[model samples]
Target: MTAGRSRARGVATAALLGALLSTTAGCGSSPSAESAETDGPKSTWEEPASYSYTLTSSTQVLAGTFRVAVRDGKVTEAVGADEDSRRQAHDLPGEVPTIGTLLQTLDRARSEGADTAEAGYAADGRPVRISLDWDKNSIDDEALYTISSFEPTPG
Candidate 1:
């Protein structure tokens, strides 16, 4: 009787395990744009040689909103929209990044196995927001960028 009871309990546990696995199969969430970057068909959007956009950065080092202009793949101008942005624009102009630069940063973060690196794209496949946290356990190694009003300029 004891041997029979043990076999029955083992069978019951196996049945429960099988049922749970079957129920959870194919229940994963859909991949987001950031994860898709690592796989699947590439985005159709390409970075223009000249463009302008509004960038709102929230991070320890850069926290401000700025109107950024990129020409010939370089940041030709950056105007701060607020006091902090203006100060950062005037003092740390090198920190003001273009869309390509931001993309590169995100890529590097992903390569380095950052704790978090996610992005949201516009309908045209342009990145509208990028969130990075190099080390979730550590403080001050995070960056959040919001891009808006992007317009490609003609040469």
Candidate 2:
């Protein structure tokens, strides 16, 4: 192609890209923008007096079972299955996502289009599953987390 024609095509392409970006730049809300008042009583997860659930990867690999009671925002009586999980449930303090952080991530996924790679939630506002990719639109099966068999720990 002629230099003039090539330059014209490049300019057109750049203009189109610019227009698309400008429109989308302001399209989404940040997680911090989520209203505290609008969230009401359900805004934060109530510390489950007791809780139990199985954690799994996107590929359905069992990470472990987390069985514990919260006696002041801390896990107690922690128990975990051994055959399948990588670590004991008691080791979850740093290994896995907490209820508060996971919920914030899920909320961001709902409001911020580009922030989350994939996400799902329970009907009662809990993180049933979640994944994060930030700027990339790719899936990481390893990052995929599914919380199943959620139940309040029985006395």
Best-performing candidate as measured by lDDT:
1
> How far out, in Å, is residue 114 in model 1?
0.4
Q: For each candidate, give its TM-score against the true structure.
A: 0.72, 0.45
Which parts of model 2 have CA positions greater than 4 angstroms off? Answer: 1-47, 57-71, 77-93, 107-114, 137-142
lDDT score at residue 86, model 1, on the 0-100 scale = 97
Q: Please provide, for model 2 over 81-141, each residue's C-alpha lDDT reduced to its tens digit, 9 standing for 90 to 100.
A: 5643435444445444445545565566556654434444465555655554444433221
Q: RMSD in Å for candidate 2, one decimal?
A: 14.6
Off by over 4 Å in 1: 1-44
Task: Give one digit per residue, the lDDT tens place, for model 1 in 82-124.
Answer: 8868998999898999999988887888888887776767656
lDDT value for candidate 1? 0.74
Q: Residue 147 in model 2: shift from native, Å?
A: 0.9
Error of 1 at 8 (Å): 60
In candidate 2, how many clashes are counted? Answer: 0
**Candidate 2's TM-score:** 0.45
